[model samples]
Target: MLKRQEVKIVGMGGQGIMVIGQLLAHAALIEGANVVWFPCYGPETRGGLAECTVIISSDEIGSPVTSTPDTLIAMTQPLLDKFAPTVKPGGVIFVNTSLAQPPKYRDDCKIVEIPANDIATELSNPKTANMVMLGGYVELMKPVKLESLKASLKEVLPEHNHRFIPINNTALDKGAEVTSR
Candidate 1:
């Protein structure tokens, strides 16, 4: 069994961090990989700090908590500070540069600051920052194909909101392209 890639996504309430975790897990599933997704759901309904841990592996998972994640996506400043130090050596941090500032820690981990909110706003959907950041994270990780992720999104997103799918997909692609450069 191949080792799984662990990702910890952190954000405040209403950031759709849980959905982002789900999308990543589904993308892994589409690629025939094993995935375990667990979200800290309690007391998260009133603008509280929330996070979700996703493990994507070619083998079965061991635990839900990732002490040292291979990658971290922070959508808020506090989250960035709280989780930045926990990333494993040689790990990556996908930062929502629009919300979180650059961290003081500058060694071991690779940090990529992306203007997720700005890009989403430009795309006419401010709430799509999650998808935008997902794109950037995927580019940084390159664990799966971009097309596979998009296909998973199309399947997972609500049916009535299908019109926004193409826009979100483009946002994901834009983020991927920018980060991969």
Candidate 2:
């Protein structure tokens, strides 16, 4: 059997949106899936729109861009509003309850609310909120195992930043824990 996932993650700059998307792409590749990570950047470097589309599939992928995503990960209210309507029916939306709430009108999809920022703060860095969201989405969707994601950190992150891996791992676990509850 083959598996596929089209994920659109939206957030502002400095939120590590691209990093999480890269993490997923790398993890998927590690699991023998062909993957693509396409990121978009707005005018401003910070507090500007940052979105990434990650396509992971057992077979080859023809397009890196997706008009409709099977999974939507929204880190803020505006981004959620902008992308919520585009998720395919029966898809899942992993929301950062610390910043965005699930849309009320979208009954066709499953909404998983995770207080990502709060969880990351509790873990000591608030910046790892993206990892928290990744954990939640991975727990629910299983596009790639959480362990695969953790392993990718070594490859994705620069050597000097390797020290943060432990907290990042904890954030991932915390996200899984919250979703399991």
Candidate 3:
């Protein structure tokens, strides 16, 4: 079991940042870890900045907010610039190379770059980029079981949108595959 883990996901407001965070939190819950998810966004709902912080641990959480994250998932260049320095040493950063430029090389932490938008477009949706990034993170860190994350999708997604579950699953799997290679 992980003693503690903190993840920060940042991107444009409509990039499904919150959904990824919620999915991770729910998956951690399914794994019986204490978890907290806090989301923040700018005024505009579409292009404005948005972010979510998720903390999962085996013990009680002292706080919900995290200043330094163990992992950072950035879907935009600006977001990456703003949060890259806040990652703890030996942490990991996942970048959406389709939209954001890669961060400067840092030996302290690992950087996993994925062309999320391009991958999603290949899947014909272009919106599951967040899921792709999330999948890569899951596969790289193994914070929670892949089965648990897949199962949590039904709960995180609304009933009416269940039709897209299969596609989202594919995106996640593709993400894992990309990172594994």
Name the top TM-score candidate.
2
Best by lDDT: 2
lDDT of 1 by residue, 26-130 (tens): 888888888899988547566898899999888778888888899899999998999899999888888899999877675788889999999999888898999
Give stretches of model 1 more than 4 Å off.
1-3
The model with the greater TM-score, 1 or 2, is 2
* Decoy 3 TM-score against native: 0.96
**Compared with the true structure, what per-residue lDDT tens digits does model 2 show for residues 68-104?**
8999999999999999999999998889999987899
TM-score of every prediction relative to native: 0.93, 0.97, 0.96
Give me the overall lDDT of model 2. Answer: 0.93
**Quick one: ranking by lDDT, best first?**
2, 3, 1
* Candidate with better TM-score, 2 vs 3: 2
